[model samples]
Target: MKVAVDQGLCCGAGQCVLVAPEVFDQQEEDGRVILLDPEPGEGHAAAVREAAATCPTGAVRLVDGD
Candidate 1:
């Protein structure tokens, strides 16, 4: 799976960062979403999904592998 966060849609809520610290973080100044591991390990899939779901602005997107 591939993860992505849209900067324009993000509002610096930090929800994604809180849910998946290993995979997501916030910019120091603006607190926008940042991808620590766009393609994180399999173990982090759940956390990534949680982050995506918890993102209040829906900035995070989870691309499934077919």
Candidate 2:
């Protein structure tokens, strides 16, 4: 799976980071969601999806078949 973060829509909630630290992170400057792994491994797909779903601002997005 491929993970992407829309920094513009982020609300600094940090939920994405908490759910999938391996694929997401929070920027220290503003707590915005950051994409740690644009293309995470298959093993991390579930977590990535969860992070995307849990994102309050929907900043985290998952692109399947990556």
Candidate 3:
């Protein structure tokens, strides 16, 4: 699966980071969501999807076989 995040839309909710730390992170200063793995392995697919689903601002997105 491929991952994408809209930093412009992020509200620093941190749900993505908590759900998929291997694939997401937070900016220390602003608490914005960061995409750690644009193309994480299948092993992290479930977590990635969960992270996206849990995003309060719906900033996380998936494409290309997600």
Candidate 4:
């Protein structure tokens, strides 16, 4: 799967990081959503989905990698 984060839309809620730390992070300065893996492996798919779904600002975007 492919993942993307819109820093501009991020509200710093940190749900993404909490759900998928390996695929997402937060900027320490302002708690903006950071994309650690734009294209994470299958092992991280579930967490990635959860992160996107739980993102308070809908900053976490996801698309099929294929």
Candidate 5:
């Protein structure tokens, strides 16, 4: 799986980081969304999905692999 956050659309909600800290984080100054691991470990798929779901601004995007 791959994850990405849209900086323009994110509102520093931090839901993505909260849901999957191993895969996401925040920029120190503005607290914008940051993808720590674009290709996270196998166990993180659910959390990443949940993060994407919980994003209020729909800034998180998930790309599935074959």
Candidate 6:
């Protein structure tokens, strides 16, 4: 799977980072979402998905068939 983040829509909620720190992070200045692993391994797929779902602004997106 592939993970992408829309920094424009991020509200510094940090939910994604909380759900998947290995796959996502927040910018220190603005606290926007950051893509740590654009293509995370299968072991992180579930957490990535959870992050995407939990994102308050829908900033996290997961694409299948990376």
Top lDDT prediction, candidate number: 3
Model 6 alpha-carbon miss at residue 63, Å: 1.7
Top-TM-score structure, candidate number: 3
Task: List the candidates' TM-scores in order.
Answer: 0.90, 0.89, 0.94, 0.91, 0.90, 0.93
* Residues 1-66, model 3: lDDT tens digits: 899999999999999988899999999999999898999998999999999888988899998757
Order of the predicted models by TM-score, top scorer first: 3, 6, 4, 1, 5, 2
Give stretches of model 1 more than 4 Å off: none
- lDDT per residue for candidate 6 within 1-66, as digits (tens), equals 988889999999999999899988889999998898999999998899889889899988977644
Q: Model 5 over residues 1-66: C-alpha lDDT tens digits?
A: 888779999999899888899988899999999888988877998898899999999999986641
Number of colliding residue pairs in each model: 0, 0, 0, 0, 0, 0
Cα RMSD (angstroms) for every candidate in the order listed: 1.5, 1.5, 0.8, 1.6, 1.6, 1.4
Q: Write the per-residue lDDT of candidate 1 for residues 1-66, one digit (tens) a residue.
A: 799889999999998888789988889999998888888988988888888888888999998640
Worst 10 residues of 3 by lDDT: 57-66
Task: Provide the global lDDT of candidate 2 against the true structure.
Answer: 0.83
Q: At residue 47, give the lDDT of candidate 4.
A: 92
Query: Candidate 3 vs candidate 6: which has greater TM-score?
Result: 3
Q: State the displacement of the C-alpha of residue 64, model 6, in Å, after optimal TM-score superposition.
A: 3.7
**All models: lDDT?**
0.87, 0.83, 0.92, 0.87, 0.87, 0.89
- Which 10 consecutive residues of model 1 have the lowest summed lDDT? 57-66
Candidate 1 at residue 24, lDDT?
86
Clashing pairs in 1: none
TM-score-better candidate, 1 vs 2: 1
